[model samples]
Target: MANAQLFKSMQQSQPLPAALARNAEGTPAYALTPRHQLAQYAATGCLNATFYASAEAQLATVLELCKAVEPSFIAQTAVYCRERGYMKDMPALLVAVLAGQGAAEFAPAFQRVINNGKMLRNFVQIMRSGAVGRKSLGSRPKKLVQAWLNSASEQALLAAAVGNSPSLADVVKMVHPKPKDAWRAAFFAWLIGREYIAADLPPVLAAFETYKLDPAQTIPDVPFQMLTALPLGAQDWAQIARQGGWQMVRMNLNTFARHGVYAIEGMPELIAARLRDPASIAQARVFPYQLMSAYMAAGENVPTVIRDALEQALETSLLNVPRIAGKVVVCPDVSGSMSSPVSGFRGSATSNVRCIDVAALVAAAMLRKNPDAMVLPFEHSVVTCRLDAHDSVMENAARLAAIGGGGTSCSAPLLRMNSKQELADLVIYVSDNESWIDAKRSGATATLGQWNVFKQRNPQARLVCIDISPHATTQAMEREDILNIGGFSDDVFKIIAAFAAGQLDPEHWVGEIAAIDIAAGC
Candidate 1:
């Protein structure tokens, strides 16, 4: 096909932009349905918020999606507001909550929350909730409290908060200052508020107590306890692991890994136990990669025992993959361009995982679960994947990553199939969608032309293009049989199964939530 003819065919395909496409009613149509909004957020697999094109546009889409599940969304409102910098546009009560969560750099935004008279009652309400605070303020919790304490309205807010919930005494105690160069009042106040085991108090606290007892007291030299009390040591971590449930244990372990402290005693056994637990296995499936990635980022020696457990757990978890019975050819594009990081938000050490890795993971899952499937690692041409049922997801991912990273040719699979006179029930291409095919590369047949020829050769074959990145358009998406999907989720298999069964529409899955009302709040 000529470039002109290829362009014409793409126009007929009605290619939908992955994230911001709208419906006939002019409401936001998310590629995944509104119900999967949180999953979409989690699917980013990292916390860095710069993954999307613009924060404003992303938040707008999120807010619109929240309308589908308003109450649950309301509960997480504070988190999104702080995490995404949506503070300025939030309702006054939410803004006030953010003020308490505090980062000193957002002092200007805090001032706006403080000055809103109508929000005072809501502010007081949040203070009285006694909820464990979020990291909205970054490293400025003390500064936040001080700013509030300096206000003329401080007494009223504090009184109201303490009156409603006495638990805030600890925060208030920490926030207030005593006489110049003295912290006696604050120290005792904090001490009285909580019960502490004798060994748990760090060496610095004993020296502080001695100093208080006598002005002549020789204070022993000790490392100062920074920000959040003493740093969590091996003993503290063991106690934390013993105290919390599986989820809590996993979170604590991950936090430790993030801080470059991974030698905690009993962590390996604890992690293994969680992986094997029936209750923990479901959440384990999605999070083990993230946790392992964290450990890898820390440059810690990841024990083979831990790695094997995660792989086993993922296999156990994916056994629930809605079985799609068919001869399917899974092609993951391993072009060098696919090595680009999926998100702009990732910084340094932890961000090296690329789009090709994501595609390979997906393809591996499909190949491992479905016995009738074949995987091909493709660049400018197609080559067979040496994937066996025994190959782990990471192992297959490594195989794909090792393939030649040259130019992209989305039509490679189709060309291979047509030449070999092969047939499949379905053909899935996992790619970044920068095909940019010319006659020199594709040899007279562009991606669409190759697909058309493949269709004639195997009329029963279905074409599925799973765009792992958010590309604006993809070749062959305009056709009725060609189903285009976007985003990163294992749940995508369920969508594929449903589409194969003719029980769901791919365009509908890729488009906005049809059931959502654009004007319900209006």
Candidate 2:
């Protein structure tokens, strides 16, 4: 048959059809291996595209575009682009095609490769929830529709986001900007107010009166007001600062105790032993940590051994406020003890700095009920970026990867934004208890934007402090003013519940574990 001969002839010209081929399954003669082929195709574009020229290709492979060409191609393409910031239409069009965005208007060079390049799917993933600047990247037509609609899962949203369809209205509603129900009501209320204004002017806008307006504020910023309620605690993390040629370390054992491990117990000893002398453990060279963290929320029934073992986990586990809204507002202690090796990726001389991941969870908890709620991060000045889950397939991925450690100067940025009154409903600041006042030079860093104006009324702006410094104890926490969130999810949620209920006070938070069964994922 002609088909059989074509398949045979294709193999003769191409190599033995390695697993890394872009259209392996479409080739019909050999099996397709995803990982191996992705790694290979990434290095060279020689993988033929003829086999995947149309939906007919999936008839043979059947794998969704997400599973097949999503990361495998995105990684290579992004890496390539990073190497060259911007190029001719070819590179950008290549990414547009592989990302699942439309590519019809692209140059012939890109069209030539669209068959197997697999860029369409990747582009779709990045711009699922109405990304800020997706329209400029060529024609992002929604090519696939009916195959996956009802299931507005992360992957589903990404696919639907870039595709073109009248059915997309429902899909867009499913992936709108409201952060939670509270946020929707808040936004809806604003819509009604707008409607009232319009009805007073235009005749066509009269029908808008029927829609009920809900008034509520959805997004909350840094929990600045909650800082007073932070549980009074012993210090946990240590800080190191370099002046000229000397490095000094500041350690807090009380915070470690608050973390639940007494200094005399084997836990503290174990941690001390590891840090003081690492050659011993490295000599064994195990695959993973030999011990499960005792820092788990074991409550009163928790075994003494585990309670003892938990002492060492306190360094990173203390003051951990698990689960926030969409994103937790984090300001790294990029000063004395928190400096990174200045020469590596992003800004690093080394990668030994500590990152505060709990703030995002607290922000997420705040925004969990809103579709548009988000947290803003800042240093000397506040960074204006807000994170949203609908913006990506798994909002959690972005949450987990929000790692930044640098010297922090709070005044410059906070003052800048305060002048503009762009502050959110709530604001929370996480730090190691070291203090800085008005450290801004000429450049503005963090802008509070009206926080000072609203401070009298919303003093407890959901602010929580993670006292990583033992010496920082008396400084940052001024009574039960800031909600104290230790670096433990089990207790962190408890503290949040208490704060929400107006009960996260120093008198009630005894550092005791909860008796109820803890969730599996937590």
Taking the tens digit of each residue's C-alpha lDDT, what string does model 2 give over 1-522?
369778755654442212211111121111123432232122211212221122233212222322555433433333332221111222333344444433322233233222211233333333442332363333223322211222223323322233233223333333333323332333233333422234232221222223113112211111111111333222211110111001001122233444454433354444444432334323322111111112223345333443443333332222232343332333333333222121112332222222333333334434433445444454444545456644421233235325454444444333444566544433445443333343223221112222333344444454444432211021222234434333322343446546544564453232222111112111
* Model 1 segments more than 4 A misplaced: 1-228, 243-267, 283-300, 437-445, 516-522
C-alpha lDDT score of every prediction, in listed order: 0.52, 0.31
TM-score between model 2 and native: 0.29
TM-score (all chains, Cα) for each model: 0.57, 0.29
* Candidate 2 displacement at residue 238 in angstroms: 40
TM-score of 1: 0.57
- Residue lDDT tens for model 1, 76-190: 3333332222122233334433444342323443443443222333343444444214423333534644555444232233232322222334444545533221233333343
Best by lDDT: 1
True-vs-predicted CA distance for residue 515, candidate 1, Å: 4.0
- Each prediction's total of clashing residue pairs, residues at least 3 apart in sequence or on different chains, is 5, 109
Worst 10 residues of 1 by lDDT: 219-228
